[model samples]
Target chain A: MVDSVIQTKDLTKKYGEFVAVDGLNLEVQAGEVFGLLGPNGAGKTTTILMILGLTEPTAGSVRVLGLDPARQPLSVKSRVGYLPDQVGFYDELTARENLTYIARLNGIPDSQIDRRVDEALARVGLEKVAYKRAGTFSRGMRQRLGLADVLVKQPQLIIMDEPTSGLDPEASHEFLEMILDLKKEGITILLSSHLLYQVQAVCDRVGLFSQGKMVLEGTVENLAQRVLGGAYRVLVDVESVQPEIAQALEKIPGVAHVQVTDTKKYQVEAAHDIRPEAAQAVISAGGRLLGLGVQAQSLDDIYTAYFQGGSI
Target chain B: MTEAMAQKPAMPDERAVAALREREGSPWTGIWSVILKEMADHLSSTRIFILEVLILLAALGTVYVASQNIQQTTAEDQFLYLRLFTTAQQPLPAFVGLLAFFIPLVAIALVFDAINGEFSRRTMSRILAQPIYRDALLMGKFLAALFTLALVCTAIWLLIFGLGILRLGVAPGGEEVGRGLLFLVATIFYGGIWLALGLVFSVVFRQSATAALASIAVWLFFTVFWGMIAGVAAQTLSPIRIGLPDEFLAQANMELALSRFSPNTLYAETMVALLRPEIRSLGILLPTQLEGAILGAPLPLSQSLLLVWPQMTGLVAASILLFALGYVLFQRQEIRA
Candidate 1:
């Protein structure tokens, strides 16, 4: 068995009958970039709070590095780095000064703080404005500064909640590359995000969370096999708006769901390659099939299905 | 905002280094971090700068006026040094009275957003997640506020002392300096009570404005309306008829005790005792109770301190109690941004 760096058993958090997290069980190996994939109000933040020992679980246990965070949170916290959603820095402090404060908070000695802060700033590519106060930073720069803060801690595990949220695609791409680079360093990364495209690129394993419950958990490929069941999306762009074509395709045995994107375009979800059947049905239903392609069901479908009270 | 967003393109920072926390530092690593960070923040904040400037100007103006009055009245006066604290010009209070008012503003400025501002700025969770205990964080904030209070008060005290020496051409006597230092300490303690109140309100309310308003409201109630309320309460509690001196005395004594509950009253009484050494007791002593007492003799420094010892203790106790309450509430709260 691999060494699990974090484990939780039946972790439940209830705020006066509003259960934020319900009977959640989880395990992460020492160097896995795990993602808690969920929408808002799905208990992603609440679960992370419990794991961080900042919030007490109503009824459960959480262990990080084989130590109970509830009893010895200081040890767990000291060993784990956390970059919260919309991380904040002292606005008046320079980038270097902010990292220096974090270094000191992480118990890095005075002698090493300067060298480490410079390295962190250069790593995050903020060394140019290292002396600039955080108040002058843009949102993207602030986010990177938050990353610098986490790096200054040099913890074994780093947890980020919605790291790419509110970021432009370019910055989010760069951020993911950084996470992957961190993974290459063998540091465990547990991040939460609603964007499947973002998490799928870097996460080794994912826990699909919804309404305070762990609806599914596995490697992306494993989850794809388990929930999608070899399902593929057949995109058909027809020449004309065809309502009966989608209904006829839905009547096909393997086709499970069909979405009419527009009068000339629609998508079909099926358990197998339904492209030929979809094209035949569209043609027979008085529509010209201009183009058809067999596509695997993307992570978007999985989230929609899982959130709409269906596991698949 | 756009300038920040339009920052120049640069090569990304390196990422493949600095692994694993060494975990060798002491548990108290974050105290100095929080203290220094917040101390710098407090000092540089516009709110503090404005209030600090206002307080210094007020202190200097009042001291200058009081010194001019002292210079005019008595050139060979005994206890001329102590008069710097108590002497007032026409239409102006003494320097110590000025402190009793300004210290609250300084303390409130130092700490009105101690807890909730962190939550609003989204820094509380990150700070608390550090290796240090919550105790260190709370203690650090309080210690920093106290340090700021001590700094401001000591600077003002020195300025007053210097001004007095230049005006009177003599240094403060030993007893007067001792009493002045004690007064400064008591003033700090008095400021601590308001700082703690601000901290408690900050913890209780999430919005910074509400916390600030709440602290100010409490300060106003205690410093201004509390005496009137206590007097009314005493009268309501014990009514006196004509020629019933005993009942009147009981009413006055009850009023004194009730007013003592206010930190301002405690602080003011303590200052009066320290600056005016002829005062013996707070209670109204009858002729029989004052047997063999010297009417106008100055009290020793030790006797003056002893006279106001309970008031000092009350201020310190109130500050501690409020701080402890804030600490406990902060501990129990879920650290969410």
Candidate 2:
């Protein structure tokens, strides 16, 4: 029942001989955080620009919120907010003035402008600094102000290009929390970043981009299973080694593979949590289980393995 | 719950759907917002404040000296008000002459960084993301700069007139006032040409300093060397062979035409025709052609305007051409930054 907020069909953008965004089909459903994970020069920003109708694609098409971005750009832009990388503001204007300018550009009624700007600023924890010149604020403060700028538009969807790229760890964490808060209000968020761990922390689904193309996409856990066979690595140590124990562990319903790392230790892989089943199987196979634990794989490990394996 | 939700078609909110179905407004929407914002920036910037002060001082000094000299030398002249603008007192040029120099500087200062400054500040993409067309942004900046130029020129014009009336104890004739207003309009469009030129460079160059330097370089070439270049070009194109009268006239006409290509020449010509109406022709006048002419008799305001119609149109056309060039360059530019 989820509506597709953004749907692109074979969208491609080229600058002379160099292709910036290859023919790509991307779909983002309503109310979910979709992360576009890619290294620099991987065409994430180009894709965002095309979706916002800021740049024309060389071929194919884009639809955002049921409107063709190229044909109905005003409609698309008014409803979808974009926070560009290293978002900038007028150094001379105060934070309130900056947000007020954006609100007016969005055609918010004069009577509602003050209310909307104040509400957005307060939402980003920037109300205290609202009267200060943006140039005087710290980098992290500017990013928050950028989020406030987007919120003033009351957008149905928000697109951010590397929103957390240049922030301290605490600031980035705070920004992600604000994004999660927006998600709680049923606002669909599409953010691009090369920081895998951050994306994994916030995105419900993610697409891996390489050289202007989406090489793989899905939930982080699903991608982990697809690439690593199984991400749940359960390590088992038994007092006695038995061939029957390995066979029994492999019989678990969700188990994908098993390997003997030592004379008395076994590494069991499963699509999902099967640690209890693994323990039962090891004991029933006439092996005395001494220790058992699981090592959860992270998105960084998944991304590294995915690229190092040259799966593209 | 999931099965039930999957089977049923979710109906979109009626009001929300209707809002989306409403026809989008004209591409010019929010253009005023942009213009107001830019105009505020131009009027408040320290650079403009200094330029305004420089212009004011120049106006006060020139008009004061010109009025004092006019009182001493031409107290009985019928066009004493017009004299305030054109009479040069030693070591200082007339107000109109000063305008010929300062107009372009003020215009260039207003707009040399209009577009590229947005990129350098990293605000271009964010602003373009608003629910407005690129046309609005470009046109809005142009009109704002034009308006700013007009405001400054009008203020100086009024100041000169006020000083003229106060010092000379005489009111300007209706025709004199009308001519003065036309002079002000010409001054604005003269500035408009440079504003548009600066905009073109701003669009072409990503660095504000480069755009500023390029605009000033073009202005310097036109102001300092264009007249000489026009003469040399006319000599090459239409040589005055054997010293025939017709050939001399042809070379003169060709040179005038070539010089008019520079906005400085056009603006200067327009100012002469408007401020000093006694002049019968802007080109070589044969004795035979002036057989019945009354020397030194100022023509009616309408005839003077007719004489400078081409020059005035040339100023406007140059501004429009440059603005169109900037618009095309900006529309093609990528907003990635």
Candidate 3:
């Protein structure tokens, strides 16, 4: 069995009368990239803070790397690297100096600090600009430097909060690719982001958060199956749609629902890939099949479906 | 015997479990790193560099004028070396007066944004996420600022002494040096109160500008308006209704007590007793109480220190109290924003 690197049981946090995180039970297995998906102010950052022991939980317990964070913060913190949202560094210090300072704070030996900083910066693709001051870095570059800062400690578990927020599309793609590389190295990662589609490429599993609660948790595909009532969304464009075509597509085995989305396009939600059967139904109803393909279930559909009062 | 043998292994297991439950590592683990980093920042900052130059110019100008004045007048005084700090030339205050006015500014500048700057720059969470406890960060900033103030004060002291020896052509007495060293300590503590005040405001206010303004406002209050307010308060509290000696004494003591609430007043009293050894008491003394006392004889170094011990303690206590307040505030603040 894989080890659970992070485990929280009924973890909760409250600020005055407002409950920021309410009785959250979360677990992330080793070597898997877990995304905490939520809109802004959904208590994702609060949960991360409790796990890192930066803020005390109002109730419940959290263990990171098999150590209680509140009791063994130093040990947990040394092992679990965290990149806060809008992460910042000493702007006056060069990238190397910034990483070196964090390395020192983590108690990395002086003999290995330079090498570690160089390796971390190289890993983040920041070696060319290592001598430049952090203040001059762009938003994407600063995010990468934040990643380099985390990598300097060589942590067993890395937690990032809104790591890709406010980045251009290309930079966010490159950053997610880097995360996938870290996952290949068998490092457990937990990242939070409101941009669900951006995290979809790297996250192996995700927990959807709403109003300080984990509304749903599983693989994206699994969530799609559970929430959308199907694992596949097939779109069929017919040259001409007859009144019986919609009924014929619904009659196909494994097809769950059929909706006439436009003049000649039909959206078919199904339990499985019924693309072949769907094409046959369109053609047999005296209509020509123009195109038929399986639409990959993006997390956005599942998120909107879940929050739009759709049946779970 | 078998039961005891079985329990022996369990004892070590329980001990291991207890060890695991306890928090790992010392809170001071990265304190030295924080202190070194902050000290480097203070030493290299342009703001502090400018302040250092301003203070150096003030020290040189005041000490030069003072040494010249001492040479012309009071050349026969035995404690002419000590007079370098207290002697005021026309249109210029004494060196101690300058210190009392400028030390707070330097101290405030050093720490006005110490904590909030971290938040504004968004580095507080990242640094707090390190292995060290918050105690190390706050204390490191405080000690770094205090040490920087000490370094500046000591440099100015040595410069004044050098200037005194060069102009007066006489070495300072052993007693003068001791009193001077005590005065240096008092000066640092006086700066410490302002440093701690800046730190507290930094913890309280998120904007560095607001913290700086708040600290300077408190300093201005103490330096300018505290004495007048104390006079009015004491007159109202202990009015001289009958115009008796006792009423006068009561009002004087009351005024002194109220003025001591400000660090400026406490610092001023401390400087007077430490620099002028002939001072017998800081409080009002009836003539009948001093009838047979030797008029111009200087008290021993220890007695002068004893005379101002309360004032010195007041400065130290205020610094500690303000620092503790900041520590508590910083500890309670949520690291998230």
Q: Compare the candidates by DockQ and give the number of the best one.
A: 3
lDDT of 2 by residue, A127-234 (tens): 999999999999999999999999999999999999998899999999999999999999999999999999999999999998999999999988988888887989
Q: Which ten residues in a row have the lowest lDDT in candidate 3 chain B?
A: B15-24
Cα lDDT tens digits for candidate 3, A1-312: 239999998998999999999999999999999999988899999999999999999988887888878878898889988999999989888999888888988999999999999999999999999999999999999999999999999999999999998999999999999999999999999999989888788999999998899989999999989988899999999877678899899899888888888566899999999998888888888788889978988999999989896446
Put down candidate 1 lDDT per residue, A1-312, tens digits, no spaces. Answer: 348988998999999989999999999998899999988999999999889878889987787888767666777887898999999887878888878877887778899999888888888899899999898998888989989888887889999999999999989998999999899999999999999988888998999988899989987766765676646778899887757887888898877677878455787777778887888898889988799987765677667656664755
> Model 3, B1-337: lDDT tens per residue?
9999989999957865796567677767888788888888899899999999988888888888888888876656867867888989888888888889889999999999999999999998898887889998999999999999999899989988988888888889899999999999999999999999999999999999999999999998998999999999999999999899899999999999999999998999999999988899999998998999998789999999999999999999999999999999999998987
Report the error of model 1 at residue B172, Å: 1.9
Error of 3 at A88 (Å): 1.1
Query: Which segments of model 1 are wrong by more than 4 Å?
Result: A231-294, B1-29, B72-75
TM-score of 2: 0.92
Error of 1 at B187 (Å): 0.5
- Comparison by DockQ, 1 against 3, better one: 3
List model 2 lDDT by residue over B1-337, tens digit each.
9988865654444543674575466878899999999999999999999999999999999999989988875556878888889989789999889889999999999999999999999999999999999999999999999999899889988989999889988888999999999999999999999999999999999999999999999999999999999999999999987999889889999999999899999999999999998987888788999999999999999999999999999999999998999999999999989
**Candidate 1 residues B1-337, lDDT tens each?**
8776655333121211121132233545579888987888787788888988888888888878878778865556767877877877778887777788888988987898898988998988788777787777888999899998898789888988998889878777887888889989999999999999999898899999999999999989988899999999999998886758889899999999999999999999999898899999876789997899999788888998999999999999999999999999988887889
The pairs that clash in candidate 2 are none
Between the candidate structures 2 and 3, which one is better when assessed by TM-score? 3
